[model samples]
Target: MTAHYFIGIKVEKSIRTKLTEWQNVLAKSMNYKDWTSEEDFHITLKFLGGCSDKTIDVYKNKLMNEEWPGAFRIAIGPAGYFGNPKQPRVFYADAEKPKELEVIKLEVEKIGSELGFQTEGRTYRPHVTLAKKNAEGMSPLALESYDLLLDESYSMLIDHFSIFRIHPQQNPKYEAIAHISLNKEE
Candidate 1:
């Protein structure tokens, strides 16, 4: 059976714990219904909607054969939202020094396109989605409050990327299908 898949950089466990703490604080004040589980916290490189096992294997092999980009550091700098503050739809943690992340994403996109996945037309914005609005709009006041809380920074070292299979409408939504180490000598 085909499953929806995406490529992402894993967040370290200590960082995940910190992020979860931040989410818990936000949950107490905001009405956002969907908070990403700590296990699923990652920086996405590409999203491949639905693909067969054969397709996933092909991509995995391609990634394994590709050159590794050396490891880099990333940090949570500030909180931000998609859409206007009055009606914010997504709440996210911005990455500090995202250049390396961008390079990885572009490579992932190129490989995905070569594999016949539709090219993403929108400009890539690298952020870890913290929560999503469910049924109600986030008040501007709440957004402002969260923005203030984001001043404290959280950073981590990135050494690998992975292909994850997502089970639609399922809790603990993502499963790592393949992992590719970065900065490794051949």
Candidate 2:
């Protein structure tokens, strides 16, 4: 049977904790039904929907053989929304995308396309999704004004990215199917 998969950078625990706290505060004011579990927080590189095991294995082998881009640091930035700011659909904490991150994303997209996965039409905007809009009538203006300030900026050294199988209806929904380490000696 085909399975759903995606590539992403796992957030470090300390950063996840800080993001969870921010989510709790926003939960009080935002009308969002789905709040991403802290353990599932990540910045997606590609969403590969459902595909055969043979296809997944091929992608996995390619990823393992590829030269890893060495570790890079990213800082969590301000809260933001996607779609219309007046009626936003996704609430997220932004990341400062350095050149390293963009290069990695580009590589993933190239590999995925080679494996017959459809190319992503939209430009990549890396963010850690916090919640999704639930209530139909709630105005995005209610969310845009809130300042989500942590005691300090959360930063992480991204050393690896993973292929995750999505369990759409299950708790702890994202299961790591493969982890490719970025330990290439520079």
Candidate 3:
């Protein structure tokens, strides 16, 4: 069986609406023809895509035993894009000097790799993805006019981390298979 797993710092539910509003503004500014639903939004720490159930359990147990640094706080966005502006591929909520986030990512990558999960080669830049454009490309008008509106920017304390199973073509789709508290004494 194939399961897509990721270690992610979950955005608090209270700020979900604010985050969604930022996305909506960007959609309007960039004139994004395609729509990205709110459920897809999250800042990925590590992507451990497609693994056996045994592997998943091993990772979960490992997480349960480790202690996180602390209640990490992250402020999302003033707006950003990945790839060339003229040929933009992704729009996202940019993290403001996210060194703590980088540290968290490195730790997860190290632990996951030690557990036999091959880590992603790309460098981590924490972000909440807003939209995606296909290989066919976006319109020049859309590309040039893409001004990311981040008026809804806010920060939240990430008290825990979660591992989710991503499945294709299903409602109640992504299930949180595991969670690890950031605070140990709590």
Candidate 4:
């Protein structure tokens, strides 16, 4: 068993399917060491890194017990990358930084800090990673050619969040440790 984990909102199936299709198209133009598995797509809120089972349990309890805002809608789209576009380190689908999403991230951050995890220093830019680790020798992504790909946006509903265990060797590497819905009692 592994201790690596993160807290995130799982991407809905329809969105996953769309992303998978995009991945297929992108693979022809980009080389990445790891293309995120469709089943593993998520909007990460916090990466807790390695933690003991005891810590996970404590973290889980705190999360399940905390109150979250009820389901809200967020816009996701316009394929983008972190770092330089041609040599991008991360390819992603970004979410507009709506207040509803930011509130939950702050709450999760507080929970993580209370458990002795170091606070994340970066600004919260909500995104679902599509791929990581750019491999050598791929054509630069031309903006005009992929207008259909970049011009569109999708609305995603956020009703719940989960703690996921990372299994690097597994095909669909993320496994849910716990799920807490904002609209209902856990």
Better of 1 and 2 by TM-score: 2
In what order do the candidates fall by TM-score, top score first?
4, 2, 1, 3
Cα shift from native, residue 136, model 1 (Å): 3.0
Kindly list the per-residue Cα lDDT of model 2 for residues 1-186, writing each as its tens digit: 577999998888988988888877766656677889999999999999999888989999999898877888998756777876655688788887899889889889999999988999998899999888655544333654554363236778988999999988888899999999997547
| lDDT ranking, high to low | 4, 2, 1, 3
What does the lDDT come to for candidate 4? 0.85
Q: How far in Å is the alpha carbon of 184 misplaced in model 3? A: 4.9
What's the residue-level lDDT of 160 in candidate 3? 80
Tell me the whole-model lDDT of each prediction, alpha carbons only: 0.79, 0.82, 0.69, 0.85
Q: Which residues of candidate 4, in runs, are more than 4 Å off? A: 137-140, 184-186
lDDT of 1 at 161: 92
**Model 1 alpha-carbon miss at residue 102, Å:** 1.9
TM-score for model 4?
Answer: 0.92
- Which candidate achieves the best TM-score against the true structure? 4
Residue 49, candidate 3: C-alpha displacement in angstroms = 0.9
Model 1: how far residue 5 lies from native, Å? 0.5
TM-score of each: 0.89, 0.90, 0.81, 0.92
TM-score of 2: 0.90
